[model samples]
Target chain A: MDTIVAILAAAIVAGTPLVFAALGELVTEKAGVLNLGVEGTMLVGAVSGFATAATTGNVWFGVLAGMVAGVLMSGIFAILTLNLMANQVASGLALTLFGVGLSAFMGKPYESVTLAAQAPLEIPLLSQIPVLGPVLFKHQILVYVSWALFAGVSWFLYKSRAGLVLRSIGESPESAHAIGYPVIRIRYLATLFGGAMAGLGGVHLAEFYTPLWVEGMVAGRGWIALALVVFATWRPARVMVGAYLFGGVTIAQFFAQGAGVTITAQFLSSLPYLATIIVLVFISRDMATIRLNAPVSLGRPYRPD
Target chain B: MRTDKRITRRITGLAVGTALGLALSGAAYSQEPVKVGFVYVSPIGDAGWTYQHDQGRKELEKALGAKVTTKAVENVPEGADAERVIREFAAGGYKVVFTTSFGYMNPTIKVAEKFPSTVFMHATGYKSAKNVGVVNARFYEGRYLTGVIAGKMTKSNSAGYVAAFPIPEVVQGINAFAQGMRSVNPKAEVKVIWVNSWFDPGREREAANTLLSQGADIITHHTDSTAVVQAAEEKGKYAFGYHSDMSKYGPKAHLTATTHHWGGYYTKAVQDVMAGKWKTTNVWGGIKEGMIKLAPLNPAVPKDVADLVAAKEKDIAAGKLHPFQGPVKDNEGKERVAAGKTMGDEELSKMDFYVEGVQGKLPKK
Candidate 1:
C-alpha cells in the first residue's frame, strides 16, 4: 500500500510539468499554430523564475515572473513567424538553441543556488486520509494549478463560444478569416498562452521539482511534453492522462529498484523512454482518430489571404 | 577518430612552429602576463565539477595576480564545439589551457598540436603528448571513506548510489563504496540508479526519493546536481555531496562530502608555465597529494565511527591503506584482486565488476 501510494505521488510530481506544456501546446495547435520551441521557452522560464525567486524570495512572484518570461520568449517567436512569416520549424529550432545558450549565460551566477523547498498544500479533510492523503492532497500548489488549468483549457477548447471560433479557425484559417475572424491575432494569443504555460513547466522544475539550478535541468522534459501533445491528439483531457502515464513510467525504474528487483541500470533506465515510445505508437495506430482530432490548420501560417 | 588525425597533423605542424617560436622567445622573462584558458563541459555553477575548476582558477589568479591572467568559457559541449573553443583560445594567445572534462581529451590534444609553445592539461583523461599532460584525482578514496560512514549509519543495511554514467570512473566509485560497506557490515548492500546525464536535477531527485522510499537511509551520487543531497534532506535521510561541499544545500542531511582541491595544482601549473619549467606530466594525485579531501563530517555521526573514518582517511593519504586492496571479490564471488596485491591504477581505471555487496550487475556500456 505504501509503495503504491509513493509511486502514485511521484507520478504526479513527474507528470505535472508535462501536463502544463502539452496543454499549452494544445491551445496553440488548436488555434492553427505549432510552436516547436517549447523546450527553449521552458529553459528561459526556468532561469527567469529561479532568478526572480532567488532575489525576491517570493514564490508567487517568481512563478509569475516565469510566466512573463515565457510570454516574452514566445513573443519573439510570434514576431519572427507571424510578422516576417519565416519558416516555423527552423524558427522554433533557433529558439531552442537561443534559449539553451541564453539561460546558461543568465544562470551562471545562480548555479547551485536553491530556493526553499516549496511545501505541499494539504486539503483539510483529505489530509487525514491514511494512504491517499499524502499521495493525493500533499503536493506542491503547482499540481493543483495544473489540474485547474486542464479544466479551464478543456472548457475554452470545447464549451466556450470563443473556443468554437478557435476550433473553426484551426480547421480552416482561410475560411475563418473569410468569415470575419482575426486569425493572426487569435494565433498570437494562443502562441503567447503556450509560451506562458511552457514557462510554468520549466519553472516548476527549478522551483518545485528539484528546487535548484543546474545547466539544462529541464533535462528533455520539454521534448517529452511535445510528445505528450501528439499522444493526447490535441485534447486537453488526454494531456493530463498522457502526462500521468509518462510520469508513472518515469518513476517505474525507482519502483523496480526500491522493490529490490535488482535490475541492471542500463535496462532499467531505458524502461521509461521505451514505455513512452510504446504509448506513442499505440496512440498513433488509429490514423482516422488522429485525423479527426488534429487541428486542420495546425502548423500552417495564415497571412489573411 | 577524425580529431586524432587532426591532432597528429597539428603536432607535425607544431614542431616547425615551435622551432621558429623558440628563436623568437629566447628572452627568459617577457613583460606580458601569462594567460591561461579553461574549457568547461558544463556551466561553472557554484557547485559540481566545473565550479571546482573555476574555484581553482580564482585561486590561481589570487596566487599570481600580476604574473598571470585567466579566462574561462563555461557550458562548452565536449564535441566539435570543444575543438572550436580550444582552437580559439590557442589562437587568442593563451599560453596554457585546461580542458576540465574527460570528454575534452581529444579536443585538448587536437588543440595542443597547433600551438606547441602552449601547455595543455586535460583532467580525468589518459592521453598525453609533447605539450599535453593528464591529471586526475583518486575520487574513489573519498568514496570509500563516505561508504564507511554510510555503512555505519544505515538503519536498513542498504545504501543507495545515484550514478551519472556507466563509465569506469563512476563504476569504480560504486565498487569502492560497496567495498567500504561490506568491510563494515557484510549484510549491507548498495543499490544504484543510473541517470546517464551528469546534471539532471529532476531525475536525480526522483532517484534519491525512490532510494529513500525503498529503504536506503544514506544516499550518494556521481551526478553534478545537489538534488541527491537535497532529496535526502527533504526525506530526513543522510547523504554525501560530491565535487564540492554541499552541506549548505542540505545542512542536516549532509554527512561528509568528497571535494576536489585543484587550486594548488592550478597555481602550480601556471607558475610552471610562467617560469618555463612546464613539461608533459601525468599527475594522479589523491588524498596524499591533497588533491582529494573530505568535507567536515556532520555531528550526527557517532564519535567512534567518525574517528575510524578519520583514521582511514589518514592511512589513505599516507599510502598505508589502499581502497582496493587484495582479497577483493567481484559481486559473483570471483576474486578480482588477489591477497597481498592492491588493485593498480590501470585496473581501477577500467573497473567493470560490481564488488561484492552491490545489488546489480555492472551495466555494459
Candidate 2:
C-alpha cells in the first residue's frame, strides 16, 4: 500500500513538466503553428530559471525568468515561420539545435552550483485523506499549478469564445482570415503561450524537479511532451492523462527492479515511452475523433497578403 | 575567354600564397605552443565525471603554462559528433587530444589512424591503438571504503544504488560496495536501480526517493549528476557521492564520496607527449597512484567508523586489500573466485554478475 502511494506520488511529480509542455504545444498546434522548438525553449527556460534562482535566492523569480526566456526563444520561431515565411519544420529544428548549444554555453557558470530543495506544500486537513492525500495533495507547488493549467487550458479551449477563433484558425486559416479574424496574430499569441508553458515546464525541472542546472538536463522530455501532444490528439485532457501515465510507468519500472523483477533494465527503462504510446494509442484509435481533434494546418506557415 | 585567364591567374597566385604561408608556419613550428584538445561527454558541471576531468585539464594548463595551450569542448555526444570534433582538433594542429568518456573508445581509435602524428588518450575503455591509449582509475576501490561507512552508519541495513548501465565498470562498483557492506554487517544488503542514462537528474531523484521509501537509509549513484546526493539531503538520508566530492550538494546527508583525480595523470601524460615518450598503454591507476581518493568523511560519522575506513583505504592503497578478493560468490551461489585467489584484470573487465548482499538480479544484455 505504501509502495503504491509512493509510486503514484512520484508519477505526479515526474509528469508535471510534461503536462506543462504538452499542453502548451497543444495550444500552439490548435492555433495552426507546430512549434517543434519545444525542446530548445524548455532548455533556455531551465537554464535561465536555475541561474535566476541560484542568484536571487528566490525560486519564483527563477520561474518568471524561465517563462520569459521560453517566450523569447519561441518568439524567434514565431518570427521565422510566421513573419519571414520560412519552413516550420526547418525553423523548429534549428531552434532545438540552437537551444541545446546556447543553454550549454549559458549554463557553464552554474554547473557546479547547488540549490536548496523546495519542500512540498501539503494542504492542511485535506492531506489527511488516506492514500489519495499523499499521492495528490503532497506535491510541490508546480504540480498543483499543472493541475490548474489543465483545468484552465480545458476551459480556454472548449468553453470560451477565443478558443473557437483559435480552433477555426487551426482548421482553415484562409477561411478564418476571410471571416475577418487576425489569423497570424492569433498564431503568434498561441506560439508565445506555448513558449511560456514550455518554459514553465523547464522551470519545474531546474527549480522544482531536480533543483540544479546541467546541460541537456531537459534530456528529451521536451520531445516526449511533443509526442504526448500528438498521441493525445491535441486534446488538453488526454495530454494530461498521457503525461501522468508516462511518469507513472517510469517510476513503476524502478520499483519493479527493486522488487527483483527479472526484466532487463534496458527494456524496463524504455517501458515508460512504450507504455504511454501504447495506452494513448489504444484509447484514441477512432479515426474520426483523431481527425476532429487534430489541427489541419498544424505545421503550415500562414502568410496574410 | 577573359574570365578563364583571370581564373587561371588567380589559381597561380593562391598556390604561391599557400606555399609562402606553409614555409613561414614551418619556420615558426618549434616556437609555437603545443596545442592540446579535450572532448567531454557531458557538461563540466560542478560535480560528477566531466567536472573532475575538467579539473585535470585546469591542472594541466597551470602546470605547463605557456608551453602548452589547451581547448576543451564540453557536452559532446559520444558518437559521430565526437568523431567530427576529434578530427577537427587533429586537423586544426592539436598535437595531443584527450577524449574523456567510455563511448569515445572506437571513435578515438578510428581518429588515431587518420591522424598518426597526434596522440589520443581515452578514459574508461579497453581498446587501444599505436597512437591511442586508455586511462581509467579503479573507482571500485573507493566504493568499497564508502560501503564500509554506509554499512556502519545505516540503521536500515540497506543501501540504494542508482546506476547508469550494467557495464563492467558499474558492476564492479556495485559488487565491491556490497562486499564492503556485508564484510562489516552481514545483514546489510544493496538494492540497485538502473536509470540507463549517465545524466538525468529527474529520473535519478525519483529512483533515490523510491529507494528511500523502500527503506534504504543510505544511497549512492553511478550516474553523472548530483541529484542522488541532493535527494538524500532533502529526505534526511545519507548518500555517497560518486566521481567527485559532492558534500556541498548534501552537506547534512552526505557521508563521503569516492572522487577521481586525473590532474597528476593528465600532467604526466602531457609531459610524456612533450618528451616524445608517449605510448599506447592501458593505464589503470587506483588509490596507490593517487588517482582515486575518498572524500573527507562527514562529521556525523562516528570516529571509530572513520578510523576503520581510513585503515581500509590504506590497505587498498598498499596492495593488501582487494575489493574483489578471494571467496567471492555470485548471488546465484556460484563460486566466482576461489577462496585463495583474487580476480584478475582480464576477468574483472568482463564482470557481469552481482555478488552476495546485492538483492537484485544483474540485468542481462
Candidate 3:
C-alpha cells in the first residue's frame, strides 16, 4: 500500500507535462488543425521559461515568458501553413526544427542553471486526508491547473455553443465555411492555444519537474505528449488518463529497482515505450472510436473562397 | 518519446581557421603553437561532468597561455557524427583532441586511425589505440568517503543511491559507497534506485523521493541532474552529491560531494603534447593524484565525524586507505575479495557485484 501511494504520487507529477501538452493538442485537433510542432515549441518554451526564471528570479514570469515563446513558435507555423497555404505536415515539421534549433542556440548560457523548485500547495482541510490528500491535493499549482484545463477543455468542447461550431468545423471545414464560420481563424487560434499549452508543459518540466534546464531537457516529452493525444483519440479526459498511465509505466522501473527487483536497467527503461506502443495498439484497434472522435479535417488546410 | 532532440541538435562545427598556412608553408616546425580541441557530449552544464571538463579547458588555456589554443563544440552526438567532428578537428590542424565521454571511444579510435599525428584522448573508456589514450578517476574513493560520513550521520541507517545506468562505473560507485557505509555501521544498507537516464531530473527527483519514502534518510546520486540534492533539500533529508559540488542546490541537506578535478590532468596532457613527450598511456588518477576531490563537509555533520572523514581523506591521499580492500563480500554473500588481497584496478574496472549492504543486485552487463 505504501509503495502504491508513493507510485501514485509520482505518477501524478510525471503526468502533469503530458496532461498540459496533450490537452492543448486535443483542442487543436478539435478545431480541425494538426500541429506536429509541439516538440520544438516545447523546447523553445523550456529555454525561454528557464531564461526568464533565471533572469527575473521569478518562476511565474518564466511561465508567462514560456507561453509567449511557444506562441511565437506556433506563429511561425501558422504563417507558413495557415496564411501561406503550405502543407500542414511539412510546415509542422519545419516549425519543430526551427524551434528546437532556436531554443538550443539561445539556451546555451542558461544550461545547468536551476530554478528553485515550486512547493506543493496544501489545501487547508482537504489536504489533511491521509493517502489521497498527499497523492492528489498536495501538488504544485500547475498540477491543479492541468486538472482545471482538462475540465475546462471538456466543458468547452461539449457544452459551449462555440464548441459546437468548433466541432462542426472539425467534422468538415468546407461545410463549416459554407455555414459562414471562420474556419481558418479558428484553426489559428487553436494552433496558438496548443502552442501555449505545450509551453506550459515545457515550463512545468523546467520549473517543477526537473527545476533545472539542461540542453534537451524536454527530452522527447513533447513527442510523448503528441503520442498521448493519439492514444486519447482527441478527448481531454482520456488524455489525462493516458498521461497518468504513461507516468506509471515510466516510473515502474524505478520502483522495481528500489524494491531490489533484479531486472536489467536497459529492459526496465524500455518498459515505458513498450507500454506506450501496447496501449496505442489497443487504443487504435477500436477504429470506430477513433473515427468517431478524430476530426475529419484534422490535417486539411482551409482557404476561404 | 522519440529522439527528437538528436534530430534537431546543433552540430556546432566551430573551425577557427587560423594561421595553418604558416605551418604548411614548407617549414616543418614542431613548435607551431599546439592546437587543441575538445568534443563535449553535452553542453558545459552549470556544474556536472561536462562542466568539469570545461573548467579544465580554462585551466589549460591559463596554464599554456599563448602556446596553445583550444576550441570546444558542445552537444555533439557520440556516434558517426562524433567521428566526423573529430576528423574535422584533425584535418583542420588540431594537434591534440580530447573526446570527453565514454561513448566517444570507438569513434575516437576510428578517427585516430586516420590521423595518427593528432593524439586523441578518451575518458572513462577501456579501449586505447596507438594515438588514442584513456583517462579516468577513482571516483569510487570519494563515494566511499561520502558513504562513511552518511553512515555515521543517518538516523534511519539507510542511504539512497539514485543511479543513471547499471554500467560498471555506476555499479562500482554503489559498491564502494556500500563498503564505506558497512565499514562504519555494519547494519546500515544502501538502497538503489536506477533512473536509467544519465540526466533526467524529473525521474531522478522522483527516485530520490521514492527512496526517502521507503525509509532512506540520506541520498546520493550518480545521475547528472541536481534533482536528488534538491529533493533532499525539500524533504529535510541528508544527501551527498556526485560529479560536482551541489551544496548550492541543497544547502542544508547536503553533507558533502565527490567532485571531479580534470584541470591537473588536462594541463599536464597539453603540456606533454607541447613538449613532444605525449604517449598513449592510461591514466587512472585518484585522491592521491588530486583527480577526485571531496567538497567541504557540511556544517550539519558532527565535528567528530567530519574530523574522522578528514583523516580518512588524508589516508586516501597518502595511499594509506583503500576503499575496496580485502574481505569484501557481494550482496549475495559471495566473497569477491579474500582477507589478504585488495581488489586490483583491473577487476575494479569490471565490477558487477554489489557490496554486502547494497539493497539490489548489480544488473547484468
Candidate 4:
C-alpha cells in the first residue's frame, strides 16, 4: 500500500512538468502559433530556477525566476516566427539547440550540489487519510497548482470568449487578422504564457522534483510534454490524462521492478518511453481525426502580405 | 538584361567561394592545443566521479606545467550533447578529451573519429580505440569491506541496497556486498531496490525509506548522491556510504564509506601521458594501490567490531585477503569459487553471475 502511494507521489511530481509544458503548448497552439521550443524553454527555465535557488536559497523566488527565463526564451521564438516570419519548425529547432547549449553552460556551476526541492503543504484533515493523504495531499504545492492550472486552463480554452478568439486565430489567422483581432499580439501573449508555464515546469524539476540541477536533467520530459499536447488532442482535460498516463508508465516501472518481476531491468526502465512511442503510433492510426484536431497553421509562420 | 544576369551570377559565385573558404579554415583550426576536454554526466563539485576526474585534470596541468593546457565542460549529457561538446572541444584545439560516463561510449567514439588527433578516454565504458581508452576504478573491493561492517552492525539480519542501475559495476558491488555480509553474518539477507537513476535524491530517499520501513537496519547505495545516507539518518537507521565520505551528510547514519580515491589513478595516468609512456590499456586498481579506501567507522560501532574490520583492512592491504576467496558457493549451494583458489581480475570483470546468498535476480545487460 505504501508502495502504491509512493508510486502515486512520484506520478504527481514527475507529471508536474508535463502538466505545465502541455498547458503552455496548448495555449500556444490555440493562438495559432506552435512553439516547438517547449523543450528548450523548459530546460533554460530549469537552469534559471536552479541558479536562483542555489544563489538565494529561496525556492519560491527560484520558481518565479524560472518562469521569467522560460518566458524570455519563448519571446525569442515569438519574435522569429511571429515578427520575422521565420519557419516555426526551424525556429523551434534552433531554439532547442540554443537552449541546450545555454543551459549546459549555466548548469556548470550547479553540478553535483544538492538543494531542497519544494516542501509539501499539508492540509490538516485531508493529509490525515491513510494512503490518500500521502498521495494527494502531501505533495508539494506545485502539484496542487498544476491541477488548478489545468482546470483553470480548461475553463478558459473551452468556456471563455478569449479562448474562442484564440482558437479562431489558430484555425484562420488571415481572417482573424482581417477581423481586426490583432492575431500577432494574441500569438505573442499566448507564446509568453506558454513560456511562463514551461518555465514553471523547469522550476518544478530544478526546485521541486530533483532539487539538483544536473545538465539535461529535464531529460526529454519537455519533448514528452510537447508530445502530450498532441496525445491529449489539444484539450486540457485530456492533457491531464496523457500526462498522468506517461507518469504511470514511469512510476509503474519502479514498482514492477521493485516487486521482483523477472525481467531485464533495462527493458523495464525503458518501458515508459517505449510505451510512449507505441501510444504515438496508435494515436496516429486515424489520419483524418488527427488532421481535423490539429491546428491549421501549426508549424507555418503567418506573414500578413 | 545580359549585364544584370552576369552581375547576379558573380554575386552567387562569390557567396559560394566565401562559404568554402570559411569551412576550410574552420577545419584547419581544429588541430590546435594539447587540447584536453572532459565530458561529465554529473557536475564537478568538491567530490564524486566528476570531481575526481576534474582533480585529475588539474593534477595533469600542474604536472605538465606550460606543456599542457586544459579546459573542461562539465555536466555533459550522454548522447548527442556529448558528441557535440566533444567535437567542439576537439575542434577548439583540445588533443585529449575524457568523456566520463557509461553512456558516452558510442558518442565519444563518433567524436574521436571526426577528430583523429584528439585522444578520448572514457570512464566505465567497454568501447575503446587507438584514440580512445577506457579507465575504471575497482570500487567493488571497498564495497566488500563496507559490507563486512554492514554485516556486523545489522542486528535485524536484513540489509537494503539502493542501487542506481543494474550495470555490471553496480551488479558486482551488490553481489560483493552480499558476499561479504553473508561471510560474516550467516543469517543476513540483502534486499535491493533499483531506482533506475543515478542521482535523483527524492527517489533515492524514497528507496531508502522503503528499505528502512521494510525492516532493513543497514543500507548502502551505489548511486551518486548522499541522499540515501541522509534519509537513513533521518530514520535513525544505519547505512554505509559510497564514492565519497558521506559521513558529513549524516554523521550518525554513516557506518563507513567505501570511498573511491580517483586522484591516484588520475595522477598516474596523466603522469604516464606526460612522461610520453602513454599506452592504451585497461587499468583497474584495488585496496593496495589506495585507489579505494574505506572511510572511518562511526563512533557508535563497538571497538572490537572496529578492530575486526581494521584487521581485515590490513589483511586486504598486505595481500593476505581476497574478497572472493576460495570455497564460495552459488545461491543454489553449488561450488562456485573453488577452495584454495581466489578469483582473479579476469573472472571478476566478467562476473555476469551472482555469488551464493544473493537473493535478487541480476538483470541481463
Instruction: Give all TM-scores, in the order shown.
Output: 0.93, 0.93, 0.92, 0.82
Off by over 4 Å in 3: A276-285, B1-31
Which residue pairs in model 3 clash with each other?
none
Model 3 scores a TM of 0.92
Q: Looking at model 1, what is the TM-score of chain A?
A: 0.96
lDDT per residue for candidate 3 within A167-249, as digits (tens), equals 99989988899989998888888889999999999999887777877766777888888888887788777777788888987
The sequence of per-residue lDDT tens digits that candidate 3 reaches over residues B1-365 is 35765544432222222345554653655546688999999878788899889998999899888788899988898899998899999999998999999999999988899898998999999999888899999999999999899889888898899998788888889988998888899999998987768867778887898889889999999988788998899889999988888888989998999999998899898888777899998999999999999998898999999888889989988888899888998888899999977899989988888889998767676
Evaluated at residue B12, the lDDT of candidate 4 is: 99
**Which model, 2 or 4, shows the larger TM-score?**
2
DockQ (Cα-based) for each candidate: 0.59, 0.58, 0.46, 0.17
Better of 2 and 3 by lDDT: 2
Q: Which candidate order results from sorting by DockQ in descending order?
A: 1, 2, 3, 4
Q: Which ten residues in a row have the lowest lDDT in candidate 2 chain A?
A: A256-265
- CAPRI grade of model 4: incorrect
Encode model 4's per-residue lDDT on A1-305: one tens digit a residue. Answer: 77678778777776788899999889998777878888889889999998898899888888899999998999999999899999888899899889988997888777656674355799789999999888889878889999889988988888999988988888888998898898888999999999999999988877776566666667677788888787766768767877876777777765564445567667776787777657755765577877776788777778776
Tell me which residue pairs clash in candidate 4: B35-B94, B35-B95
| Model 2 regions lying over 4 Å from their true place | B1-33, B64-66
Tens digit of per-residue lDDT, candidate 1, span B309-335: 989999988888898998998889999
Task: List the candidate numbers ranked by TM-score, top first.
Answer: 2, 1, 3, 4
Per-model lDDT: 0.88, 0.92, 0.86, 0.79
RMSD (CA, Å), candidate 3 to true, equals: 9.5
